[model samples]
Structures are given as C-alpha cells and as structure tokens.
Target: MEVKKVDFRNKIRHQRIMKNTSAEFTYSFPVIRGIQAGREYYTTMCPLKLVPRLFKFVEDDLPPDLRAQRTLNKQRIPALARYIIDNKESYAFSSLTVSIDGEVHFEPTDSDPIKSKLGVLSIPMESRFLINDGQHRRAAIEEALQECPELADETISVVFFVDAGLNRSQQMFADLNRYAVRTTRSLGILYDHRDPLAQLARTLADTVPVFAGMTEKEKTTISNRSRKLFTLSSIYQATKQLLRKGKNDKISNQEKKLAFEFWKEISNNIPDWNLCKQKKVAAYELRSDYVHAHGIALSALAIAGSALIATYPASWKKNLKAIKALDWSRHNKTIWEGRALIAGRLSKAKTNVTLTSNLLKQTLSIPLDPSEEEIEMHYAAGKK
Candidate 1:
C-alpha cells in the first residue's frame, strides 16, 4: 500500500486539556495515516528517507545534553540496517515513541470515537523531535535508506507524546525497558536455523549417543526433574572447541561426521552416560554426582579431545577409552578439587578449564605442552 502525502488544508489543528482521576495535563499530538503490509495504521509513519532529517540523536555538540535521549550506539546500527535492507519486503517494525517540546495543535475528526478524539498533530518547522525509544531502529532506518533509495516510500509507525521535560522522558525510557525479557541462549540456538552452529548443535543432540534424548533444547539450566544433563548451547560451544571452528567458519559434511564420531567415542568412554541412557542410573543422579555431566566438563573434554586428535589422530579413539578408568565422581576431591571444583563448588573459570583439560590429556597419555604442565603444577601446589 502506498502512503499519500496529506494535504495541508485538510489537516486539522486544535488542542484540548485532558483530565483523569489522578492527574490532568494537556496532550497535543498529530495522527498520521500510512500504508504498510497492505494495511493502514493511524499511528504516525515517518518515511525511512525522512528519519535522518527529523530525528536528532544525543550528541556532545547539542546544547542541554540532559534533554537528549541516550547516546546512539553506532556499532549496533549497521547490523540492524543490514537486516532492513536485506529483508525490506518482509521486515516488520514496532512503533517508536517520539516527543516534541514546542507548541502543537490537535484538531478532532467528526468520526472520533466516544471518550477519544482524533486529530492532526502539527509542529512548527523549527521544532525537533526527540526519541524516547527506538533510537537504534531510527539510526538503522536512516542508514538503510541511504543504500536503498527505493525504501524512501516505506513507512514506520511513530507515537507522539507531549514532552513533559527531561525527567518524564527518562522515565519513559526506563518504563519501556523495565518488563522486557531477553531470550535464553539455549532457546535461541534451538529455534534459530540461520546460524550453522545452531544447526549443527541440533543435529548433534538428535544423532549423538550422549546428547540423544539427554539434552535440554530450550532452557540453559536443567530443572530437578528435567531428565537432561546438557544444554544445546553448551553442546554448541563444546562442538566449536572440538571442531576448532570460528564463529563464522562454514562446516562441511566431513567435519560434521568427524564431530559425530568424536562425541560418540567420548560418550562410550563415560560409563555413567551409558548407564543413564539405559535408565539404570537416573539423569539427576549423574548430573549431581559426576563432573562429566556438566557443560564445564564437556567443554574441557572437547578441549582435551582437540589436543588428542591433533597429537594422536590415528589412535585417538583407543586412547579416549582411558577416561573410563579415571575417577569422574564429583566427590573425588583429590582430582576434581582445584580443577573442575573450587572449595567444593563447581567453577567454570578459564584456570579451572585449563586444569581440567590438562588432567584429561594426562589420563589419555597425551603429553601436555609446557604451558599446560605449568597450570597443572600451579593447581597441584595450591591444593597442597
């Protein structure tokens, strides 16, 4: 749907003071009509082309800094703009809240609903609008408009609220974000198909022995009765370690097969994992009693497997069986303490990861490098 420009003569301009049970104040705003996704909304729709000209972000040079919204994050704008430019056809955006401090007029329409009035909001040409929310979106739209001039006619909704002052604007920002919930990493990985790592993690969970029917697909932490020991995100990170793949590196079929085999071999070496799979040992018991049942240990095992594969590629599987002989019980203080555990509590710190991996390398008869040896010695001395 195309949004036609409003005629100045038909635009209504009037103002009325509104009163409520607790407070009475004047609200002056203009209602804009625009077409998007084959539907029309009465909310203000600022053209992508006009975003840069109409919105002013907080800057050091702007006078009265406190009145401005939060500082613009230049780094995050490009990625969002790229999404708009790439998916302009299907992209959807929520409305933005804007504030104007100068004088405005609101004229009610004849078809206005009861207890509510419709009007055309008008502000002087000299007046500027401040963004209380959606600054990043505004910046992204501005950038997207530059690369895609065809988007100039595309409309985005904007809500106009009468500017009370700096305090109210700050409160608006806080209120807008107060109840917002962020998606968990495991859930994001579980649902996302665009990321190759997420795809591989899901595949591993379904195909690998230890992960099959034993991985948490959505939540990061398992509940007491969850029946799962590892999270999808943890498997994703540990697989990245095993494969030595960077964030953006593409995975080939061969690499996927290798990862499947690597995890399968590790699972065979851990007896408790098999017992849990067979229903002989409860998932909760393994999780609570074994070091190998947690993400930290899985990641450390991946690190050790990477080293083993690099040093003993031809016989890595045979050597991985050594893990079965080692004491994996969380209560094995002599080995787990100061390595996977600190003061009888699990620690996921880099130092602990390094110490734990070094121990795995030694168990597999894979010689640790000088640095790994040094870290192991430090932990050993600390334990004494």
Candidate 2:
C-alpha cells in the first residue's frame, strides 16, 4: 500500500504562496517525511527570515487552559536574541517543533526508490502554523533579524506535525515536555565555556590544593556517603559572591588571583579542612559534624571575605586567620542554630547566608553595613 508520489517544481516558492490562498496554492518546502508512533511527521529546513512571518506565536490573550502552547515569555527574548547576535559565528539552536492545522502535500523526489522518504512538503498558505516547542528560538530569530538582517538567509531546522485541533496540540506540548529536565548546575558550569566566573570555578576545582581532589564536578549536592568535600557550583557561587561580580561579568586577572589566594588562605586556616587534606580524618566526618564543612560555610566565608577586603584592605588575610579557632560543630546551637542551620540541618536560604556572613564579619572584627545590621535586628526581633 504505497502512497502516491507527487512531483512539484523546485521553482515553486513562497512568492506563489502570497500570490494566492486558493486550494491549489501551497507554501512549498524541501522536506524529508517520516512516521513515528503510527503518526506522519516531516522535517524541513526553514530560513530564519520566514520564521516570524510563517509561524505565529500562540496569542497570549488565550488563557493557558485553552491554549495549545505555553505563552511566550517576552522577558527571555532579549537575552536569547543577544546569544545569537553576540555569537553570530558560532551560535547553535535546536529544531523548532511545529503543528499545522490545514491541508498539506508531499512531493517525493523520483530519482531513486531507496530515497523515497526524501521529498517536498507544501502547506496551504491560509493554514495556521503554531509552534509546539522552540517558541523562544523562533521569537529570538525574529528579533535577531532586526539587528543582523544578514542572518535572515541562515536556516534553522523545523519539525512539523499535522493536526486539526487544539486538544491534540496541547497533548503534544505536554508529552514533549514531560521528560525535559534542566541539567544540574555544576554540570552546567563544567560545560560552560562562556561565563568568566564559571571558567574561574573550573580552574579552582582543578588546581586549588583544597578543591583539586575532592570537588564534585557534576552534582550540586554531595551525598553523605560520597567522598567529595566541595561541589563545583558551591565553588562557583562562593567565588562569585567573594568577587561581588554580576552574573555575566568578565573576571580580570587580578580578580582571579584574589579568588585563588583567598580560598587557599581559607583552606590553610580551617582545622577540619587541613586534617582532611592531610588524611588524618575522613572528609564525611567533617561534613557530618561541622557547619564549616558544608557549602554554606564557603558562601558565608566568601561574603565575609568580600567585606574584609573592602574594610581592611591592608590586612584582610590576617583577619581571615581568626577562623582557625572558631567552633564550627553542627551542634553549636548557640552560635550557628539560626545563622547556618535550621533544626540541625544546613540551610542556604537568603537570610541564612546573611546571618552566617554577619557572624563571620563580627568574628573578624569587620563592621557591618546598614543593611546587614537591619537584617540582624529583624532576625533578633523574630527570636523574641
């Protein structure tokens, strides 16, 4: 039961689509047809310039319950557009998944029976093409063209599914996203070649004496049974906080040197960290027993480091040495119960970081800024 193969002229183009919406007129494309799960689908390459004009975003006016696709998040468009614009020579985007609600035709190239699946796809000009996925890419391409009109000719892969109603389209959207999972933060940092802080974190994880052998490179959280002592993301975050850098800020050589030296100094001063490095004690023992062995300790120390450098530019390293004698036991309820732990479990909440850093600042004899004092006052008020 072979379906008929229709031959369409290669010259047939979108100009004809605009000329008429008659039943005979269709938007033609070179596509390869395939079947999956007993349903017909097509894959084609489309010019970026045609994306905005060809596939319309689901109107936000429709309530989410009634819509087939998620509403476009306009806030995300600018940054995405910038990725394309900035990395015009090397940017990569995945295929856009689309659904069509009208009639279509396929013209298989008749050169060989073995290549029958290779063909041309044509849809009626009046048909509606709604993006099921990659709506952000579609929107971003439209935006990128505004600034780099030359990119209009560049092509993006598109996946097309034929359907007649919203119910099927909605199911498509749900089914597509059901298994989608964001990569773990540490893994993202590991693979990231762009962010300067992420690059610095990678360097720290590899070369720093304390982090080299024990840093967990892929997972954000370390299990109690695991041998690793620090997470790559924690190193990334702590360095970011220590430098007071913005998300996409560039790191100078001087800043990188400062981060390396500060973490090295911290490693030298922590008794448990030194013991673990010397193999005198197990890493998990410190992690389980001391508040300072967890990621929040690094975050709190980084925050304090930033302030110490700011307030005591001449002797920040000397001030940083005071942590060697501090009691960092998890059971130190009087010192760390509210600041770094809640119910004896380490917490990384915003207030917890602030409170923990405030304690570190006080220990180093550094003065607190007004906002820190305000938050301290609020925490005290809540306690009573």
List the candidates' TM-scores in order: 0.79, 0.93
lDDT tens readout by residue for model 1, 58-125: 55455544644567778999999988887877788898878776666555555656423545665655
CA error at residue 126 for candidate 2, angstroms: 0.9
Residue pairs with backbone overlap in model 2: none
Global Cα lDDT for candidate 2: 0.87
Q: RMSD of model 1, in Å?
A: 7.6
lDDT of 2 by residue, 305-356 (tens): 9989998888989888998788998887888887788888889998899999
Best lDDT among the predictions, by candidate number: 2
* TM-score of candidate 1 relative to the true fold: 0.79
Residue 381, model 2: lDDT of: 83
